[model samples]
Target: MKLRKLITVAMACIMVFSLAACGSENTQEDAAATETTTEENKAEEVEETAEALSGTVVITGSTSVEKILTDMIDEFTALNPDVTIEYTGNGSSAGIKDTKAGINNIGASSREVKDEEKEDTLAEEVFAYDGIAAIVNPANEVQDITMQQLSDIYTGKITNWSEIGGADAEIFIVSREESSGTRSAFEELTGVAEAGGLTSSAAVSEGNGPVQAAVAGNENAIGYVSFSFIDDTVKALKVDGVEPTAELAKAGEYKLSRPFLFVYYEDKATDAGLAFLEFALSEEGQICVEDHDAITVD
Candidate 1:
């Protein structure tokens, strides 16, 4: 009887060990399966997001915002190759109209949305800030200008370059079309809007590129353009003794800055449209903005 009892105890012990070993193995297998499932789910989520973001997004708006937008688009598309973005350099007013009418997925603007343009369905995001630089040909010696002086120049009061300490020549005024957001913002900032708008005789360019080109080729011409558009061919004048740099604009030391906006109809925007808009506001997108000489929204 003692032998039988010892044998029974040994067998019971063996059975217990076998059960524990099996449980341990099963637990490890379960853990591995769970980890694999988690990884697969994460991948699926990423794939879904990418899939949803694949579509065409049409953007139209201010010529002032075009260069920065292009830079942002290049960065954004690198991360999302499946997305397509088309941009047209129409005036800000046309952009607003297109966005409002659902003709475009997004509208770019260098000016604030006017009260008359606001609606419940329409939404706008400030993607960046830009300074309107009063540019002159590099050959011109005018280095700085006061707001009052700029106002006078645009209003046809200061027609002679000598009136503002520059060389003796008739100031050839280069102005933007009435629908241009840059023009609206520049005029408002310089108090030219209140002084009866840009002078009627000023040569009007339809886009920033044209304005820059006209100024770059004419030594007597003076025009304003987005800071992003400034290049070696043109010299940007200091406004009110403050240099028009992104740093100064962000610090509020430069007074000629305005908001760069993305306008869209909230309810009608495509997934890709919303995604692109958010991307432009993201930290990475802001880096692209700064890289192109525009200030980030932050």
Candidate 2:
């Protein structure tokens, strides 16, 4: 009887050990299963975030900023295949008016919003800075001019290139139209009156390309254009001894620079508009600005 009782107790101990082992195995399996489920859920969330967003964004404004903005839009749309962007290169004033009137989703301007144009309902975002290059014909020997000299030249006080150290030739000034953002920024930077500080004497070009063409064709012509527009056709002169470069402009060393702005009405903005604006302020968008020869804002 005693041997039988001892045998029974040993069997019971073996059974308990077996049950504990089985429980331990099942607990490990359950934990592994839960970990796998959590990983799968995290992967799904990542996939959802990577999905392309869809919408249409409408941009209208400054012709000076059109090319850069278009380039950026192209890159943005490439990443988000479902999104479409339309840009209209009217003048800056028209862009502001259209934004206020709710005709466009966003207004692009190369200049900052004037105090009078600011309203509680309107918002401005500055994404980049652009240097307004003072260009002269390649044949002209004049290399640099001071801000005061530039102001005087635009104001018609210095009519000959010889007055500021150049050849004995009359200074033929080329200027953008009055409605141009480039013209506005140039006048404000140089503290010159409207019409490129001219008294109806300067030749008016409709756009940067035309202004470049006019200056390139005339040996004695001088004009201010976007830094991106400067090429072999014209020589970009240093102002106040500081070169007009995007880097210098960003560093605040270049005085003839202006902000690249996007204006919109807060109440009128669509989801697509808001998304595009966010993208425009993203790292990728700022890279696009740098690629287009503009200074990105920090």
Top lDDT prediction, candidate number: 1
Please identify model 2 stretches exceeding 4 Å from their true place.
1-52, 194-196
List candidate 1 stretches off by more than 4 Å: 1-29
Candidate 1, residues 168-226: lDDT per residue as tens digits?
Answer: 99999999998899999999999999998888879999998999999999999999999
User: TM per model?
Assistant: 0.90, 0.85
What is the TM-score of candidate 2? 0.85
After the best TM-score superposition of candidate 2, give how far the Cα of residue 132 lies from its true spot, in angstroms.
0.7
What is the TM-score (0 to 1) of candidate 1?
A: 0.90
What is the Cα root-mean-square deviation between model 2 and the actual structure?
3.9
User: Which residue pairs clash in candidate 2?
Assistant: none
For model 1, the run of ten residues with the poorest summed lDDT = 289-298
At residue 39, candidate 2 shows an lDDT of 99
Each candidate's number of clashing pairs is: 0, 0
Whole-structure CA lDDT of model 1: 0.92
